[model samples]
Target: MPRLVIVFDEFAEFKGRHPEESKRLIGIARQGRSLGVHLILATQNIEAAVDPEILQNSTFRICLRVGQAQDSLQMIGIPDAVNLARGRAYFRAQARQQFQGAYCGGPHGKRGESVSPRGIIWVRRDGARREINLPGWADGRGHGEPEPPQYTEAQAIVERIQQAARYLRIRRPALVWPDPLPPRLHLPEILARHFQGGWDGARWSVCRPLRAQARQIAEIQPLIGMCDDPARQQQVLLQLDPERGGHNLLMFGSAGTGKSTLLRTLVSAIAHTRSPDSAHIYVLDFGGSSALKPLESFPHVGAVVTRFEDERVVRLIRFIQDEVSRRDALLRREAVDNYRDLNARRAPSERLPAIFLIIDGFGEFKRLAPAELVRSVGALLGGGVAVGLHVIVSANLQADVPNAIFANIGLRLTFSQADQSEYFRIVGRPSEARLRQDIESPPPPGRGLLRGTPPLEFQAALPSRGDSDEEQATQLSLAAQAMSAAWKGPRPPKIRALPFLVTPTAMVEAAQSVAQTDRADLLVPLGLDFDTLTPLAVDLAEDGPGFLVAGTGPQSGKTTLLRTWVLGLGAQPSHDRLHFLFLDFHTRTLAAFRRLPHQNAYVGSAAGLDKALAALDEEVARRKAQLESMYEAADGDFDSGQVIRGWPHIMVVV
Candidate 1:
């Protein structure tokens, strides 16, 4: 749509008298660019005709044919543009938009110098446009554009400095300036605004090429050969932002490409950020123990390992679904929706470290006898991310899995795999195609091609040999033991748990050893609970027989329970008074007895519990006495005599 149009309106009133008509023509040419127009006013007038403003904006000006070189100086100064052939005009140093056609050195300009006349321009996209106006050499480093009245003065001086520096490579001693400043510091922030330009040996140089590309913001700190070299390791890493939103990245490389290693370092940097609401990365280690196995003991890791439990798994699924629902609701409610906000609004229930689930060997998920894992993958794709859930599923597929999975798994990392087709499916096509066949040839131990965006935006230091797996394990085990020991402190003479969660104030610790005399005053009926005693209790809340017991606590009626721990179901006259027990220590010196309304009674003891012969001994003795009594009396039913048999005895202690 940018077409060339020249306005000769001011020159229309061509008066030979040379009144003020010339001045008007120059003004129209100078201001036209601001209004989206460019003017080339060709005139054969003197100083009285041209306006200063009009001439200042003229990036190019020339004379078709003038009286003398002096007259040409008015248009181009120093070397008169009019001296050249009629159509072979030379370039003139001018400011502003419009250019008067003139022949120079190169195809665009001269061999030594190239002038864009109207600053410089660059395209962002297919058909986008932008003009660059940079400040001093180090835009906004030391000196910046002044405001209002001072702004005009600053603009003129800056351009003069630029031209002087360009034309004369050495600082122009010819044109002495009242002011001088040091070189500017270069940064992305300084380049986005105004710019500075100068004439170099054969051409002018402008820092901002005005070439449109991606917008970037980085408050870069000084580094030892940092921007120049990215492969070098940096101790302190900071990520520079590209554009406004976060970049979804993909990583593709062979094994030992340091994908997991680099991801760890990046995670460390993110943890050190001062931004309160920054979104954190959730690493999903789907590569067995090798991928995220090391993360099992790391703090701040939301590591989840799969276990075999049909019901428990269902519950976990429900929990994941609920988490997704909650995050979706939060997104809808918040005015400023971003990962940062959702992170801040995390509910107390969601405060279990982070909610990241590192599902190892995702392929194995389908192999397990589960129903429709592929369908479940859909939910994982939809709301898994926003809820602070990140998944790093590993597959040998060259390209990414499916569009849906690929979309959700914005960040991709590929370990070494032979199949290019699979890699293409796992990652994108470009990366897979490039590294597919190459991976099969056996890359160097710790080297491979890299794809996807660079995180940590830097490199991580290699660990020394001293940090080997066995050494690390030993250190960790020692530390855990030390911590546990410290918590336990000195051992008590007796470990005593009470009948309830509360440790009874009545309880006292003994110094040395407490014998049987120590428990002489122990009550007949007592309660055994968590605090005073490490009583094993079943969790009514959980299905199956899940019982927990810790160290010893206060002893109570454990012996009583051990005594009558067995009986046939429904054979007992009293079930409420009965219990079950496994004989270990402390099940001696006690007899349990339960009597019915009749004089006959049911009795059990630790000694009798171990034998069917003992039950037979007691029953046989009673039956023998009953038989003798029946003979002494007459005929009678089995009571304390005859063969009195109700049910067989089941021994629990045995």
Candidate 2:
């Protein structure tokens, strides 16, 4: 459906160097007319370079100049080319004609000055002068003399064409061979290109309309990088739209191929375009913490976990799983098909931000994490996209990824692999011959091929304006700080970690407000729970018959637990309502609580234990007698319960 024109200059040299390609060109010249393909070849020695079949198939021929008449005759069946002046040629299609070709170079006067026919005289020793004439010494008025032009007509024509194109809002074609991508593409430059406003010295101020549109569009699609589309002869913005393209993205390449750099670029772009309320990012840096560590300062970044922090990693994974479930439930309740629909229907304040989970070193994670966690991650991928949970992972090799996870990935970006085999294995064989050649060539860092209908080669943008690692890190830090300063909205909810040490007063202050004051007496706050990070307590009235504090080794919090229980009860304002009998044998840990009003008895030795037990037995007997008399007073009706009033709750510790 499309027409292509192939031009070959100096056909003789081209044919001599590439015989196979010359033959293929001959074949195309014979049958390419029907395929909408045309060829134009230029050469001084047409008799030797022009194939017989190709000459027979050629419907048009043009001869500019030749050294011999034979070449002129062979080109147009006429010897007129040999005598033609510069820039003059003979054309032959159905008939022979003479014309002058347009000159694209500088003024012809500069070119003809060296060949001018002005006569010069050479003076001899005897003072006699001899005149000599240069070659082609005919008068300037001859029939086939060279002429000079005032200006370059070709340049004028090109300028006019460019002006017209600009007026019509048409882009010019890209160069056949573009220059290599620069080492650094600054974040500000990229942001300026994609966004529609300039920086006001402090922060970027995007146009209100454009900003609104970007926020709305960024909900489903976000720009990732700049793509060079050689086939289309243009550069375009690369965006990953889950609605149109794939939900998950996979990037694989050898080390130092800019996979990590590209990951950071994605986060920076999202931070600039979408607010913290609309999108959030969580990074799991299995490769190293340096790549994504700077992003933690961004308001949109909820957490950045490294490989060494196993507890944090597990917590991040669990958080993602819980978020997925929550969004899935929200979708079901609202009768929405996906996150986009829910966002469209819900109010802005109630909308859930999309979560992007970036895994830097997926291979190492798969190997180090437990299989159950790995499976949980795989399950998250299955339906995470529909609920606004997207996974962007990078690996060293395709084999390291599981098929289940790989199947969910829609968009794949591949950087320079170790070998051609590895490249083909990741993106499959490229359909274009030029693409094959390009991939075979060694590429620089950040150079990658994005797989699609026609695979696109792109240079990933760097966040820094400088090349060094420190400069890049500094740039990221500054960008994050700027974004944070510009944002005035509510920050993302942080994932809290349990405190290492908590105090009784802090626990009591953290206790939930209850209607009954005695409920506080029955509940003793110990520490915070892991899942909710809320106060964890023991219900004294409900959790019976008693409590046992056990540990694996000495100083494993057994004594600490008992002391906390004793102190927590003593610190409560209603301390007199509860009683305690301490039997601390090895450690006098509970001795500090001996002065409290709640202390019924404090026994520190084995002999004291007997006294404490006797005291407990006597109190129990008194309670039993009191209950028996109450039963008798109730006419032996045991169901009619009656008990002594003002009896305190007694707790024992050993």
Candidate 3:
């Protein structure tokens, strides 16, 4: 272990202000020698006030120019210091010695030689004095004063010592403090530093394999930011290790504190490190600013849902839940304990990509979302990590986050909080020194304290090269677009959603295809299934002999759904056998269906509606009579399983 040294420049004032600290220093001085810990205490004229214990334990002492002989005697047991000139001091150990301290202010050059009025005088080896006339030296005084010796500043000398130490492979004492973190760290610069190879045109020709795919779990840590360890004098790359640092992350900060920007940078880092097949990102931007909207262009991003997208937000949460369930089943079936094991056993092409679910403005989401949804998120945070599902949630305040959810998250980041109490609550109480330092100088945006083995302070990298939000957003978009265009790997499975508009012709084709494959009594294609993205069809004869198409508000798809059903029915070969009656209260809505050969009657007026109903009743009575006559012909034992081919199915749209 390196030796420790504690220095007190003005011991008298420090002792006056902090009596306890002075006592502690005395204790350290007593035991420090055996423990390789040393203390240097300095005072000008207050040597008599110094603690006797400190003086007794101190192995060496130095006394510079003192005010009185008594002060010199008190310091080094000698009066020599009183007569000492500036830059001169007396050291007292086994014996007293005088020495001149080097000046640390600045360098000094050799003084020019002074000359006599006639010339400079030179003393020859033969003991003969010769006066040499030099124009510049021929002033007045004889071969004047000798030139002063050149002096090197203490700083330069120390620098040279440091250079020599490095060359000699000698270790230096640890720094008392680390350098302050930079105000800004661009993502491109960080990526370039860590990853090998540069852009080959627009594509990154990576020379190093991705950390996500590393064979060892320890080596799979992904870089997030740069961490500053002041005590250790180290500025190391801050990586989130899944094996050691739990998967879920919770970040707390005030608005515009770079919470969203840090999330964006994390996504960008993942994209640069992992292929679309290896990882996927799903963002729920409840922040309302669509801060993560630009990430939608990345091939690795499966979805980016904003606050305005109410349905999409719900769907996105459901999607994540479904993914968890899917991974659970997959791992059980494969006899794997976790995703990492599953990936190791399976081929790269067969591996399931890791899912990163980032919920921005989680406080707002918790407030608006249903209790069940919030609970579902909590459950995900608890068990999702085992299956390669990582959830990162950020909130503006600690109160907005539930303790149940907060406890499950392992990695935590706290940005500039509104108060010291909030910061302490998020990352636990820091040391007094840390509190004093941080409270005096609050961190700026993008600067945060990360909770780990030893809490570290880090500066998050920017997602783009630009400083302004607009420029960063634009640059992020362009980068995403470029990556999407250049990517040759398979993209993440897209979230299934119904198209806004489906043409009647397309519906007809879909229905016809379904009819040829599987014969249903009466199947009509409705639309696409939300979960599977497959064509969804309703088996009218199986699921419902009678069905009602209903919705709230105008143009709520009631008319469109009814029209799609009618069109789909008409596309089937059995359409000729089917009969449709259109009761068009709003004539224009169902007018097109009246031209179909399957249509029995098209009634719009009130008088026509009654007649249409009476005619339909008469037809029902006729069909009943025909079925009864057939039963009588068969000796009252009609074949129950046999199909009645003469009867045509009647469908009504109202």
On lDDT, the candidate that comes out on top is: 3
How far residue 550's Cα lies from its native spot in candidate 3, in Å, is: 3.8
Q: Over the stretch 1-654, how does candidate 3's per-residue lDDT look in tens digits?
A: 767888888888777656787898788767768888888888764653475777788778888898788888877887777788999998777777777775677853334433223234676434489876532233321233333333544543354345445545678775677778898998778777766543333665433533445453422344568889876777977666676575778898889888998889889877776666778899989887887887889989999888777667777778888889989998899888898888888787898888999999999898888888888899887678789888889998888898899887878888877677876778776555556666688666788888754567889988878979888888888878888888898887666456677776766666666653333546778886676556778875556668887789887888878877877778666666688898886646888777786656788877788888999899889877877777777864577335454456788778
Tens digit of per-residue lDDT, candidate 1, span 597-641: 212223244463446456546765876686687667865543541
Weakest ten-residue segment in model 3 by summed lDDT: 135-144
**What's the TM-score of every candidate structure?**
0.34, 0.76, 0.76
Candidate 2 clash pair list: none
Instruction: Work out how many backbone clashes candidate 1 has.
Output: 52
What tens-digit string does per-residue lDDT give for candidate 2 at 181-230? Answer: 55446665776756664333355443222344533543325566777776
User: Candidate 2, overall lDDT?
Assistant: 0.74
Cα misplacement distance, residue 366 of candidate 3 (Å):
1.9
